[model samples]
Target chain A: MPRYGIPEYRLPYEMLDRDIDVITSLGVKIETNTRVGSDISMDQLHTDYDAVVLAIGLHLGRSTRIPGAEHKQVCKAVDLLRNITDGDKFKLPKQAVVIGGGNVAMDIARSLARLQKQKFGGVKVTVTALEDRAHFLADPVEIKECSEEGIEIFDARGPQECIIEKGKLKGLRTWKVRSIFDEQGRFAPAYDESDELIHEGDMIIEAIGQMSDVSILGEQLTEDLEWNRGRIQVDDNGHTSVEWFWAAGDCVKGPDVVHAVADGHRVAGSIERWLVGRQK
Target chain B: MTEGHSSDYERLQSKKSLAEILEVAVEFERTARDFYTNLIPKVSKQIRYLVEELAEEEQHHFDLFSKLKSRPDIEQLIQAMVDTPASDQRFSDAIHLPDLGEKPDDQAVLQFALGREHAAMEQYRSLAESTEEGPIKELFLFLANEETLHKNQLEKLYYETIHSGGV
Candidate 1:
């Protein structure tokens, strides 16, 4: 059978780099190390360039609403992966509990397992998720690898709180999940409180989801921009409510390489037509 | 000396089922992804393009293996395969990737890509040979061919970068 899902899947980092090379070769100018509304200023870029496409992706990994969620010991899965990718030799935790069931959670769990195996000569990582094994969002192969690598996974557990004692993260407390979705298929988790369990660990990682860093929009622009259900409103062609500015990528939609790619093409096409209209 | 981590990693590397083979394939792609993406920001502008493209190719391979990983037989096959002994590859520190902040230019990136593609191609080739004519065999051959295509692309790109006065 043919491999890959809709619109074909390609790695993001690689695709961006190679495409940048191709585009640069075609005489397009690109700049890096310039953060929007910070280093270079988003308003400046908007005014300087004829058309601006905000393709910033959702980089901040989501954290659960629980006490001690803001504790230093609690790490975002994206941050952990970013630090690892950005070459940080972080002090490896002896025991870690990753709270999520998605692929990112599996990845962090395995990554921690590798670190723990190196540090203490064994894996002491646990992954807890609200969804049962049958409903886990991570690929089965990833789950299998997690078992092979000695990382434990517990399903049907809803994270109720991050257990912190004396301002130190001690563990993650969770109740048994009865149902993850309601009859309407919405995320309305029902937990069995009597079956509460406190999983002991030195470190806690959150990998539920990710969101965009739109702080760079500044207070005024953020207020001016129209939002759809908390996301920057954009049309099917990625055109925003305001002309001369467009939004796409994870910032507009959610995470997925395919969707981001489609957004890229759409934005490019829209920009082309826009510039053409301006010229005429 | 803590050879345990490396050894355990090698154990994970050992293929037991078609699923394990595909999983191993995904892991290698991840390693390649890490290696190349890390190299991109650190390298000079002249060579960043090459490293980025190489990284992209690794991610592409990762995606393919990921698709292969979702086959119907894997869930059951892995349970039984876990009991088998680990492979005895001498170099066990494969998981300890080089510090990406340094240690690679254009040529090095290409060479790394070449190494990864070669190893994966060989694994897939052997797999294809061992299996009887079926969907499984075809998958292995396809993966192997994918690697071959990458190998060729890297080789040509390597030549271009080298002879073009800047890599």
Candidate 2:
């Protein structure tokens, strides 16, 4: 996450490399460009090593499935962030509309705003979310910085459709959300049909959420494993159903740096205990 | 994974009656309660309470569905016309109880329960996503969110039970 998912501004690359240097200093082997389930099979790993830890996090960005969302201009925040980190070429939109009200959304918005500023000497980015300002899922600091960056914020707006003119992307059509949850506390968002607005932009970014790409586990391993929601099921100690295999980090739990680090410790402890028991 | 991402959103839509949906949901809860109750004997003494709590939570969900089924407002929605073969396939298909095998450890049992809770949450989420915005959608969304919260709670309890100083 620190390497590619997070922006350089938030987490400097030098600091990330230094932390990696410390881990490598301790004789830990780090491999790059070696894709698991492709370069090496899980069965081979089980035979070669006593344990296998799968910490493949949520790398795929989710789509809202609204009409016109399949357009090239309608990008996922996760993908955009990764592209920016990889130094890949991306067209900076003159006006962009971002959906979602989380830290990632803010990151994308602010990042794009900076890019636009550099390219055009101005920023025209709009962020719309289902939650009102009182209940934004984003950190207060992120929200504040977005305004400081001169990005527009529209709270409680539920995306209905992506506006496309001819073959090009236009903007997003959204309605004001009356309530995000029902009396029973469900995620069913009710919108005020009368209160609607079309935010004009050439690009729309869906920063709603992300999910782990489990296809890398291969078909057999996926079927053999237990899953919760869409994540591989693991015990409190991060042990998977398969005795030799274990999963932790964002693959088992959602995104959170502290939680991921805690999980790393938890899984390490479990592996240590197992190794000790094996020795005895 | 993200909470609402489903590839089969369109295919998951049911033509079954609202009453049928409630029936299947209630049955799901009942089966979950039974599953956890069955696990109680397999788990260790220290974590037996966890199984009991899980079973109780399922019962509470069942009660909520039952109450909703009896509500006067729900009757109108239940009778609304929608065409398709009626079957409890979705809920029934998702109901797979984990095999604890012989001499189950605390971690094994907790892992099994976590799997069940996650499956329950996923099923409800799919239902919520497939259905149009309405009371029924709200109902399924509510169930899904409840399962999510329950899953989070169970994760916390599992850590406290399994870890020494809390990772």
List of clashing residue pairs for candidate 1: A14-B56, A37-A42
lDDT tens digits, residues B1-167, model 1?
A: 47999888767665466555566667878887887777766755435567778788888888878976776764444433332222213112343465544645445565556666666666667767766776767777898899877876665554333211100
Per-model TM values vs. the true structure: 0.57, 0.65
Query: What is the DockQ for all candidates, taken in turn?
Result: 0.01, 0.04
Residue-level lDDT for A82 in candidate 2: 92
Task: Please report, as a residue range, the 10-residue window in candidate 1 chain A with the lowest summed lDDT.
Answer: A1-10
Please report, in order, the local distance difference test score of every candidate based on alpha carbons: 0.71, 0.78
lDDT tens per residue, model 2, B9-102: 5335546677776787788788888988887776544345667787998899889888989888888788653432223353467566656785
* Model 2 chain B poorest 10 in a row by lDDT: B158-167
What is the CAPRI rating of model 2's predicted complex? Answer: incorrect
Task: Output the lDDT of residue B39, model 2.
Answer: 78
Clashes of each: 2, 0
Report residue A98 deviation for candidate 1 (angstroms).
0.6
Residue B30 miss distance in model 1 (angstroms): 56
Model 1 residue A233 distance off true place after TM-score fit, in angstroms? 1.6
